[model samples]
Target chain A: MSTPIETDVVIIGAGPVGLFAVFELGLYDLKCHLIDILDRPGGQCAELYPEKPIYDIPAWPEISGQALVDRLMEQIAPFSPEFHFNRMVAGFRKLDNGRFEVETDEGELFHAHAVVIAAGGGSFQPKRPPVPGIDAYEGTSVFYSVRRVEEFRDRDLLIVGGGDSALDWTLNLQPVAKSVTLVHRRPEFRAAPDSVNKMFAMRDEGKVRFEVGQVTGLKGENGQLSAAMVKGPDGEIDIACDRMLPFFGLTMKLGPIADWGLNLHENLVSVDTEKFETSIPGVFAIGDINWYPGKLKLILSGFHEAALMTQAVKRIAHPDQKLVFQYTTSSTSLQKKLGVK
Target chain B: MTKISIVAFDSTRFDVDAENGSTVMENAIRNSVPGIEAECGGACACATCHVYVDDAWSEKVGSPEPMEEDMLDFAFDVRPTSRLSCQIKVRDELDGLVVHVPERQA
Candidate 1:
C-alpha cells in the first residue's frame, strides 16, 4: 500500500481554479494536498453567494455559481487530494531541499515540493456596513451568504446590495420566501440586467419591496435581525425583518502572498512566462490570482496555466528523465502518464 | 469566426468555431468542447482550462502576459507549450491554430 504522507504540491485554496490545478496535477501523477480557509469547497463562490446564478461562464447556459462549484467538487472527488479546511495559509518559504514550508493561520506547517497559491484572490468575509448594535447579535439572526435557503423559507429576509448576488437571490426567493425586501445603496443595480429586470418585475407586482438607501443601524431583539434603520433620500426609515443578507460583493485579497518576495504586477505574483516559475523558484502562482495583458481569469485559463506549470515542475523534479513519458516499450501505465498518448 | 483545433494529451481533438472577440479558452467553452473549464468564469483566476499551443503556433500566440504569468504558478504539470487558452484571443493571423488540453483539471 502506498504510504499516505506529504505531497508534491499543497494547494492553498479549494476554489474552482485550485481544484482545476488538482486535475492537472493528478494527470501528471504528482501527489498533492489541498487546503482552504473555508470549511467546504468552492472558495469565494461558495462563501459569497452559492445561490447566485452566474451568466458570464460560457458553457453553462444558466447555472448558479454555487452549482458550478458543486460540479467542480464532484470532479475532484476521485483524486481525494488531502483536504484541510477552515485553516488559512498565513506564510510560506522555500527550503534548501527545494520544497516549500507552507504555514497556516492555525499554526500548522506543511512540507511540500511545490506550493500553488489558489487562495482565490485571498481571504474574504462579508464587509458589514458600519451599523451599530450589529456586533451583539453575532450568532442570532444575522448571516453572511445564505448557506441554507430552507431556513429562510418562511421568514422575512432583508437583502442589501444592488449587485447581482443580492438581486438574484431576491428573485430566487420571490416564490418561497415569506417576504423579501431588497435594499440598495443606489437606485441603479450592479447585478446582471436580467436579474435586475426580474427584481423590478417583482417589485412592480408587489411581491418584493425596494428601498434605495444605506443601512445605518441594525438592531436585534432576542439575538435576531429584528429591524433595520436606513437613511434614504426621503428620510429615516425603520424596516422590520427577520434576517438581513449583506451581499456587498467580494473584494479580492492578496493575503500573505504579498510577503512571498515574488515580483508583482499590481500586487499579483509575477512569474517567468516560459516556465511559470515565480521569483521564489519552487513556488508558483495560478488562476485569477495571476494576471496577464488579456488574462481571462476563468477556470479554463487556470487549467491551462496548471498544465504549463506542471511541465516546468516535471523538468525540475526529474530533470534527467526524458522530456517525454515514453521509453519505446508499450506500457499500460504510459497512457495515464502524461507522455504523448 | 476563426477555426482552431485543440488536441488533448489523451489524443482527443477539437475543431471549433472561435468567435473573434473571445479568448481561445472562452471559444473552447462556448463551443462545448470538453477540454477547458474556464472556471472563475474566464477571469484568469483558475487554470482549469489550460492548453498547449502547437510548436508552430507558439510564437504567434505571444508570450504569457504579466497576469497570465502570475497565475501559471498555480497550474499543475506546467509545460513549455502551456498557455491559458482564455488568455489567447481569437484573431485573423491565428486562423489555423492548435492547442493541447491537459488530461486532468483538479
Candidate 2:
C-alpha cells in the first residue's frame, strides 16, 4: 500500500474567507495546506483595490479591505500552513482510498485527507478580453489593473469597462494618471448613481473622456500599449495610450467541484446545516463552497462556519475524542496567576 | 410591510417583513438575515452587503450606484444579478424579492 499524504485539510483560494479558515483550522491543532492563485492572500481584495473601504466584516468597525486583510493574515500568521502561491487549481479527484488529490495549473500535485474548496468568486482569473497581440506587451506595457499605482503616477492610461469597476478606477486615477480615457460597450453604466455623477462631473471638468464602445484590439509596440483600437458608436479608431487597464471584471469559472454533485442553490454550492457535507461522503465542503442555515457569507460568517466545520472534520477524523470548545480569556488567566485584575 | 423571502445558501429561508422605506440590506441586517453583513452602515464604500437580486425580481431591485458596483468586484461571488444589499431600498416593487449571498464578503 502506498503511504498516504496526510494533511488534516487542504484549502483552496487565499481570500479573506480562506485565510480565516486556516486560522480556524489551527485552533483545532490541524495541519492544513492552503493554495491560492494570487501571489498573496486577501483574494480579490488584494487583487483589486487594497485601499478600498470595507465595513461588513465583524470587528474593527470600518477598515480598508487591505487593512482588514493585513489583520486577518496576522491572526493566521502564528500557525501558518504550507502556502502554494501563484498556483491555480485545475480540479480535484477523489481517490479510491477515500482521500483527495488536487491538481493545479502549474502541474503540481497535492493529496489531503479533507479538502475545503474555499475558492471565492474565482475572479482572480483577470478576465481580460482577447486582444490580438496583447501578450507581446506582458512584461513591458499592456496590463490589467494597475498593480502598483506609484509606477503609473503620471502615465496616460486607457481603461476598458463601462461598469462600476471601470468608472471607479477612472475616478481613482483621475488625480494620479496624466490622463484617463474610458471605454464602454453599451451606452448605459451598470454601476451605482454616485459613481455615475462623479464621472459626469469629471467629464464636465475634462478630466475623463468616455468612449461609447468596446476595445476591439490592442498592439504593444516598444514594450508599451501604444495603440488602443476600439469599436465605438462613431466608428473604429485607434487612440494613443501608454497602458491599458481593462476592468471588465474577472469571469469566475467554478472549478471541478461542481461535478461532485453537491446540492445547489441558484448555481451556488449547498451544504447541510449540521454537518456541512456535500452530496457525496468523504468529500466535504466549507466556506463559500458550501452553504448552510443562516449563512451570512461574510468573513465573520465564514469564520463561524469554519470553526464549526473544523469540529465536524475533527470528529470525522477522530471519532473517539470528544471535541469540547474551550473559550479562552488570556487576560483573566494571567490575572488569576499574577493576582492582578 | 411588504413580504419578502430570502433563501440563503444554507437553504434556511427567511420570510421578512420589509417596510416601504429602509434599504434591503438594512432590513436584512436588522431582522438578522443569515447572510448579508451590510458593514459599511449603508454607505456604498463597503461591499459586504452584497446580494444576488433574484433573476425574476431583478428589475424591481433596480441597479446599484457606481461605487457599489465597483465595491462588488471585491465580493466573493459576483453575478449579473449582484447588487449591494445596502443600495436596494425595500419598496413596493421590492416586495417578495429574494437574495442569495456569495461564498464570502470582502
Q: Itemize residue pairs with steric clashes in candidate 2.
A: A55-B39, A56-B39, A191-B65, A191-B66, A192-B64, A192-B65, A192-B66, A193-B65, A292-B10, A296-B35
Tens digits of lDDT, candidate 1, A16-82: 8888777667656667788888898888778776776666666777777689888877766555677
Candidate models: Cα lDDT each = 0.74, 0.71
Residue A142 displacement (Å), model 2: 2.8
TM-score for each of the candidates: 0.69, 0.67
Candidate 2 residue-wise lDDT, A106-145, digit = tens: 7677777677767766533665455556677765776666
* Candidate 1 to truth, TM: 0.69
lDDT tens readout by residue for model 1, B16-100? 8887877887777766777577656677765677887889999998888766654553344446677888888899889999988
Off by over 4 Å in 2: A1-4, A89-111, A219-223, A259-267, A291-298, A330-341, B1-106
Position A284, candidate 1: lDDT: 81
What lDDT is obtained when candidate 1 is compared to the true structure? 0.74
DockQ of each: 0.01, 0.03
